[model samples]
Target: MPNKNTHYKVKNLHGTSKDRYSKKKCECDNWLAHWRNNTKSQRTTCAVLECARKATVGAHVICVDGRMSNEWYIVPFCKYHNHYEKKDEYFLDSRVHLIPVYKLDGCKRG
Candidate 1:
């Protein structure tokens, strides 16, 4: 768990990959499931700070601070907030767990 005062800067990377990784699969079936499994917790609200909407999808985002920029992370997001048009960077709640998309990052169940 993260401290309540902490926040992580992240940028939505949806639609940026041209669907290249759309077919990629993890042991948990979907990115949202992967996130839930890895985090060991369930979220009812969006991960974006100040957003109280219900979370409906696992959004792909990248850390904007250059920490593991090449890696993609999964965060819970509402349908409206998950769209590509909302490209502005936002701060995620510190308690939200970022699940890695890659299987080798320990998202695999074996």
Candidate 2:
């Protein structure tokens, strides 16, 4: 959980610039800095309705057995859009999500 102070700092930054670390993406663009550079491991874009560009990894996509829940879930969001979107979704550090759930451990993603 983020404290009020942290939230204030982020808000201040985001209010001024589109930097997620600086906290101003809604004003600029949703993708964060250093994203194209992090592609060596696991990195990708937002899984929302019609978003473009690459989002940063926030969680490892996971799903527990037989439960319509995000128990083992993850949230795929850039530092910017993560704070903005998710109509009906969950994600993880890898920053990816697919509806109706997929076998994350069952499949491999970059």
> Number of the top candidate by lDDT?
1
Count of residue pairs whose backbone atoms collide, per candidate = 0, 18
TM-score of each candidate structure, all chains considered together: 0.80, 0.29
**What tens digits encode model 2's per-residue C-alpha lDDT throughout 1-110?**
42322221111011323333333212312222222222323445654324564656433233432234443233344555545333333322223332222232322233
Name the lDDT of candidate 1.
0.77
Scored by Cα lDDT, where does model 2 land?
Answer: 0.33
lDDT per model vs. reference = 0.77, 0.33
> Tens-digit lDDT track for model 1 on 3-57?
2247777888868435677556667667677778778777889999889999987
> Which pairs of residues clash in candidate 1, taking residues 3 or more apart in a chain or in different chains?
none
Q: Identify the candidate with maximal TM-score.
A: 1
Model 2 bad stretches (over 4 Å): 1-43, 59-67, 70-72, 84-110
